[model samples]
Target: MNKLRIGIFLGITAFAIGFAACSKSDSSANKPDPTENGFDKTAMLTNYADNLIIPAYTNLQTQLGVFETAVNSFMATPTFANQQALKTVFKDTYLKFEHVSVNQFGPAEAALYTNFTNTFPTDSAAIEGNITRGTYNLTANSTIGQQGFPALDYVLFSPFHLNDFSGPNAANRKKYVQDLVARLKTLTGNVLTGWQNTYRASFIGNTRSDSGSPIAFLINQFAFEMDQLKGPRIGWPFGKQSAGTMFPNNSEGFNAGISVALATENLVSLKAMFNGNGSGKGMSDYLIALKKDKLSSDVMTQFDKAINALKAVPDPYATAMSVNKTQIEAAYREIQILLTLIKTDVASATGVRITYQDTDGD
Candidate 1:
């Protein structure tokens, strides 16, 4: 063989060897061995301390600050001193803080104030009247006969039922804090689940085929999620008020009141759109047309088709953690098909068939 040919072959071999070495290095870089770093238990602890523990502690403190401000303001006013008014105020305030506590810390923290050791005085009408009548002259040391303002007890020593938190009392605080830490540890596992639920909702699905945009889908979904979260009615556990759902006087209620108000507004807006004077034609006319009229079998078929498509969308909570991205995409496509049909046909497309019977009519 020629010397030149032999040299070229040797050079090619060297180049191949160098390329192989580089590839191996890249592969090793890509797949670093987890065992090399061992278990990052300290890092995990640090994450909990920073992300979970610190945020939760800070949130509780902020809530307490708000609670303190509201309570102090209530005490300053005479009308708030009325027995009924005071009960409502306390109930409202307790519900507010209790909700955040429960949502963040779970039912156990929620139950911290379940049993009232000492109740805030609901029968302080005379005191409230006096305080209301003489507003600016109120003192922290002011006494109502031999007894002091029941509100003051809450302000100073944290009551058992009303103040279900880790306070200055080391023993009580330690117990609650331990329980909280335990709960937080459990919640750490479920963070991804909650994240998926919140995250997916941020991306909206296009319902309308003609003018459907991904951005629009996201915006609509975001709005819907927010609406559900801020439900006008009882979205979650807080709606059952009449069924002997009792809360202690010191329990936070202001936040609950705010939620209730928000829910109320949402409902009112929806109601106005569908049934109020804003829409001259009510549900009754639409329902009667849908039910009584001799509509084509195609209409029923379309309605059933749309209903099935909608029903196939997986339960919202099921995808709380991880869901197949393709599954979500398919669900959105089915919905968009139904939306297209609705947009195309006004009469046959709309499948709202409710009987709005008039009881007292002319």
Candidate 2:
């Protein structure tokens, strides 16, 4: 071969080799390990811990503080004015609870934060029985229906239920309300401290996709939160789970007439968590990194569609549920479709195995 031809051929070979090496490095950087075309789990975890999780807990703690103050003020006089003020703050703080509800792992799981904080249509019967008897354990799991936001909903907004604070059973009723708020404060505060003090570092550092890793836990808990939104938050009260029995008051915050508001907030936070609280490092980013762009886009689109449908529902969801069942069911169907996308498509793309047991087979 001629000298010029040989020199050009060697240059081309070197250039090809260098380009191949660069491509491989780019793909490897996206992975959980040394494999090509993977994601940086640590970066995702760090984004979640720092941006999404901490901020959510801190905001919730701030709302909780305001809520506790409201409780104290109401206890001081138990006047109608105090009752109204307390109810306002109670609803705000309860809505804030949805922000941190999806993070039910590690400290939250240990705290049983969601179950303790928002279990609803709280058992008014159980709460009343506890107050009448002047005996109940606030911390016990079985007493969930007797405590939390729902119980407070009953205490503050149920039909003339708050009148007992000025009636013969005043002291007992007041004591029960005080204890319920205290339990919520303690459980929520502990989980926030857990995340802030040490769990943050632990979560960011352990960057595996295994069942116990941050990814697995986040995805699993995310699905669980969605299921809660679909089933307990809407379905049960809508009679989807009761053969169309239509228990409107069974909805969360129904006594306070804020069921739609709470459900909307819960879903808003879920979408934020799915998108990394707008930090640009959420599951959507992870999926996009894997070149699943269409899946990522579709999930987000569904989220928007669901949120819009939910917003279209009239307020006072409890009363509206009876006549507007069709509209509410339309919103519920949208939520269910979003749930399916996350469980099947998002879970499949991320490779995070969902460990939560599902009865509805989402």
Candidate 3:
């Protein structure tokens, strides 16, 4: 990962903490309370199928096409600007990780663990080795330059880094790859746990309106954040690394790692909920109504469908790594759409009547 990404990740993490303090829960006392408004699960489900699930999934497919095309172009002729753009798309796509975790797994730790493993498997030896070794350069005697994208290393390598360009010591290199794979698994597991606890609690569980489920509010906030993060992945192909055989064009880890990282941010927010100062608790209460009317379960079910669709994205480690740019782009494109749609449904589920901003809007 580049410093820019690291910085963004860290910044987002910090912002989450601060954001938790002020708007943790909505005041339910002021609003109308939940009454049995016929709890229209059927109607909600129908609308969800038509408006939320189907549209979101379809949109994901379309975005995937665009992502593939853009990445293909950038791979053939990459530059710094394009690299940044690709990274942006990646960051945005990651928002789905949080959305999927909450809806699919609910608020349980076990559910989160399962979601992370399936969604962002941390078994890629090349990617982890690159990040570990990539922390600094041997010859450069300093960290890789600002434009030095360590994440690129995973793309170019064969499953075991076949060419052995990673280091001079073949034996050490092999050991490194093995170690890296293990480390990635450990790192991702840690990150997933942290992310789930933080974001979900602070945002989703915090708001509990009979009129509007706290779950819905949580997804909405996530979608809003995701829309903001959408540029980097698209820009990756256009980077200096994207054009050459040196970069190898594999985006499997790049995308997966990013998504997992953002998920970490959401978990952080969720953690804040235990505190009265935390956003999760505060936001949940804030959204509840004085009047107890049943919020639609149909929306939640539709949201669930979207979550399942996101979960449908094949495990990153399951597929063979592709060296060809076209193949890699195709893979990324396919996954990108699913991620985008996942965010769309999450936003819709939040049921926030306000016009939510699309953070990544052109």
Candidate 4:
């Protein structure tokens, strides 16, 4: 969830703007087909599509179904008990989102899921503005910050923390919450449908490793998500960019204070996707075929380091940014190491040109 940027995907390049894979050389597909190395690109693609990408979206659909029903129950009852239930399912669904987030190339790009689904420290002013107005376009790009899981995090835990669902502005607040979940369900479900209906066959069929190939998109996004973990998810709130001044509230899921868990889950997703979610053919397998086994092994080792470091940080991450400063800094450093490995070392090894602009200059 980016803070400084709103329209951009923060880490991913402009594949969502158009058919960037066809014309752009730096985003998704940028490397020549490496089939000469006997890595079985088609098999890798099939494994990713069948085992990793599609399955992630499918699970997300299930969690979102649960989340929508939870919202329905809460809105119907508007009680403290129902509110807590909604919070539980919200975190579950948000965690599921971390998995699908890595596959933000084919159908996810078509849905602009990256652009809308996760931006935080959400626009509190904009969100309140929409709620008070009692009408706003949740689907519009202008409403991006107010449209995602982060926004729901705030709506669920912070603003209405005192079980105000049945109190002041009850109708408007309930309507806003309902609209947010509805938008999330519709947009995310459409992405899943796109994958199941058509994108799956094409993604597994095209084995070419061009500037627009699915392999490049997957690998590029792997690094992009890692970069995001290093910066927005960890560094920005830890004050890596602001002269050692902490903006702890900038933490993703700040209101719910699940920042550490979200960051840990993001790293876990990248590592899982990289290693084929445990057993399938992933980028590490391709690296092994190319005889870059050390790089492959180093990447996994660093993923462990990063995940462990992040998990070391206590919950309510914003508060920990001050109370647990040393632990937060250590986690940030490990995340930086992982980013360098994936974006630079691994990108070079895989033959994909990584391109995404950020002011942090890391």
Q: Which candidate is the best by TM-score?
A: 4
> How many clashes (backbone atoms < 3 Å, residues ≥3 apart in a chain or on different chains) does model 4 have?
3
Residue-level lDDT of model 3, residues 1-362, one tens digit each, is 34334333333333333223223343344242223232322333233223332333334334434444544444444455554575555344333333332222122222222222222112344344544564422222121121112232243222444344334644444443334333324433444454344633333233233223443433443443332222232223223233423221223245333432442333332222211122122222222322211222232333344334333333332232223344444434433443354354323333443233332232
The regions of model 4 sitting more than 4 angstroms off are 1-15, 18-34, 159-163
For residue 111, model 1's alpha carbon misses the true position, in angstroms, by 8.7
TM-score of each: 0.22, 0.87, 0.35, 0.92
In the range 222-244, model 1's lDDT, one tens digit per residue, is 22222232221121222222242
Each prediction's RMSD to truth: 26.5, 15.9, 14.8, 2.7
Model 3 misplacement above 4 A? 1-11, 22-161, 165-167, 187-217, 220-229, 235-362
Clash totals, every prediction: 17, 4, 61, 3
In angstroms, the error of model 4 at 347 is 0.9
What candidate 1 gets wrong by more than 4 Å, as runs, is 1-45, 79-256, 260-362
Q: Write the per-residue lDDT of candidate 4 for residues 1-362, one digit (tens) a residue.
A: 34464523533435444335453554344444537477788778888888888888889888888888888788888777777677778888888888987887777876678678886668878888887889898778778778788788878788545465777877888889888888888888899899889988878766665446776677678877877887788887787778998887777878776889888898898898898877888888989987999999999999999899988899898778768888888888888888888888888887776644544657
> Model 2 over residues 14-58: C-alpha lDDT tens digits?
322333343344433433441225677677778888888888889
lDDT of 2 at 48: 86
lDDT of each: 0.28, 0.75, 0.34, 0.78
lDDT, residue 219, candidate 3 = 45
Clashing pairs in 4: 29-211, 29-212, 30-211
Model 4 scores a C-alpha lDDT of: 0.78
